[model samples]
Target: MKEGTVLIIGRPNVGKSTFLNNLIGQKVAITSPKPQTTRFPIRAVYKDQRGNIIFVDTPGVFGKAEDLLSRQINKKTLESIQEDIDLVLYMVDHTRRRDFEEAKVLGIVRKIEKPKILVINKIDKTTPSYLAQYKFLEKEFDRVHMISALKGKHIKPLIDDIFKFLPEKKGESEVDFHEKPTPILNIDSKTYVAELIREKLFLLTRDEVPYTVNVEVEEITPRSENLTYVKAKIITTADRYKKMLIGKGGKMIKEIGRLARKELELMSNKKFYLDLEVITDPHWQERIE
Candidate 1:
């Protein structure tokens, strides 16, 4: 058996989280179409007969950030590319035009001495010529795999190839694929619960609202063997945004809570009593600093 750590790096909204969820065949990470949807580094374990792949899904690598939150996110993303990693899965949205940020990321990746593979994601939304745009990437990496993380295109082959980068074991024989292997992750319920709420907020709210707000889990109390109570706060920068989130007659917040609770219940496999509140704090992100 072989084991390795693979860091998934890319600019925001490139389906990095989506790829992680698809690879593990579970929703270990929350995802949204909005840029900067991922704010922290999430780790998940994918195991098979070949070995195990511990994946680190990072925030999108972007150029300078004005806010303290964005700065911290960018720093975390770059810090993930460490010597301890066995392979780097550098993903890019094939449909978008390459920009200065992409060039900056490419330059940093070029200096890394670890083995890496260029994964061109979102191929389902592009034409064959999309490959031409990223042709330069082929020369920089040992191999390239074009895939659609959302549509689950060519995911199995991508996973198979990822195992090739892991350290090999002697006297290891291939195991039966029919015997399902259980995937594992070291994520806590509180963090993932907050992420689930944040994902719904992003999908429900409009421009600037999603980025300005942050979800914080206050408590997760087990009411019974089969039931749990979760209390969380949605922190925002201003009162107006809070009003918008709450909506007239508290309809908007109710919808957000309803959707988030449903997902959390399914994820926890327990009845969840989700208590959500929106608070206005202009320096919510900075206060953590």
Candidate 2:
């Protein structure tokens, strides 16, 4: 039996979040079409008859850090990968060639001195020639695999390879192998609630509205045995955005809240009374955590 941690790092919009969700067979991380959707390292567990593998999904690496927030996100990505990891999965969009960002990311991976796998994601969008272009990378990596994360193609072989490189464990488990996989991190209810709201915010709004907004869960209280009341404040960069989010007759805010409430109910298995408010806070992202 083998057991260890795998750290996944990649450039922005490389499908890191989608890959993690597909690998784990659950939605442990929130994903969107936009870049920078993931801001922190998300931890999940994958177990089988052989052993258990702890997976950490980190924020996407970008070439330029234009703001303090981007710099902080980059720091978090590096900090997670530098830990005592058993393996590193460096994913790249198969449709795109190696560029400056990929070069920079590889430099950091080299310094880690751990066994690494080069994953070419989104192969469904590319042709055989595109895949062949990266074939030379096989010699540079411990192992390389091309996969379509969104479509779940060629994943079983990848899983086999992932477990093969992990360090072996001593004991055998008596528990049933059919049992469901569990999460490794102690996930906070408020944190995920906030994240779900932010995800919906990204999907509902366009352009800078999503990027310039942040969700703050002000209160979560249990009002009854199977009922909870949640109050969240959506912070926007300007009064114009705040009003835009509110929309005429409060249409936009209502839609966002409605979708978020439905998801929260399914996740918590409880009835929820959700109250949403939008406020202008241009420096919300700049505030020290």
Candidate 3:
């Protein structure tokens, strides 16, 4: 049996996360139709007669990281490319015009020593000629696959061809498709906290504010019924920003807490309390070493 890991990577809004869901046939990651919806890497095990592919959904490669969380995400995404990845699924949204980052993506691809397959996604919005015209990209990569992950068109051939190119690790030969165990990769605890707080900010803020707000989980306490107390710092660059987050009469913060806590309960399957506070720092996130 062929067995290894595949990393899905590309620019933001390229439908990388959506393609991951289609490949794994599960919704292991959330989709918001927004950029940067995926904060942490999510793993979904794909097992079939041909092989088992552990697909890792990574945050889309974008702007240079200015803060701790953004820096960490970019660092991790690049680091995954350096890992023992079986293949790299570089996806581009075919419906939209390519951006400057497409040049950046080419640079990154040049640096990746591993074998890669370019996938042109969002074909549901294009004509055959639109996809057929990417001869330049076809000449650039060893191989390319085209499909709409949303509609599941031409996915089986892509998956079949993907396994055909994998370099199998030792002990994989002993594995059986029916008997091979599926890997249930869970989110890292520390990263989970950061994502929770970031998601809370994404839910609460508007305009450019959500992008500016960076959260850090400072503490956690365990309690009965599997409850865990969480305290996070909502860091902003100015006192005015902090005041905006806290909202009028503190109502905004309260609402954020209420909404986040309810989602937390649904996620943890336990009751827990939340204490949300705001802080202003010239550059708390600049503390990144």
RMSD of each: 3.8, 3.2, 4.4
lDDT of each: 0.84, 0.83, 0.72
What is the per-residue lDDT of model 2 for residues 157-262, given as tens digits with 9 covering 90 to 100?
8889999889887476322345643655436778778888888888888887887788888899999999999999999889999988999999999999999999
Candidate with the greatest TM-score versus the true structure: 1
lDDT ranking from best candidate downward: 1, 2, 3
lDDT of 3 by residue, 168-231 (tens): 6466343354563343455555456666666666767777666556677777788665778888
The TM-score between candidate 3 and the true structure equals 0.75
Q: Which clashing pairs does model 3 show?
A: none
Candidate 2 vs. true structure, TM-score = 0.89
Report the lDDT tens digits of candidate 1 across residue range 1-289.
8877888988888899999898788888889988888887887778777787889999988766777888988888877886478898999888887888888778878877888899999988855345676877798897899999999998888888888898874363232335634455556768878888999999999988997898899999999998888899999999999999999999889999999989877766878888999999998887663
Per-residue lDDT, model 3, residue 38, is: 74
Better candidate number, 2 or 3, judged by lDDT = 2
Determine the C-alpha RMSD for candidate 2 after optimal superposition of all C-alphas: 3.2
Question: How does each model score on TM-score?
Answer: 0.91, 0.89, 0.75
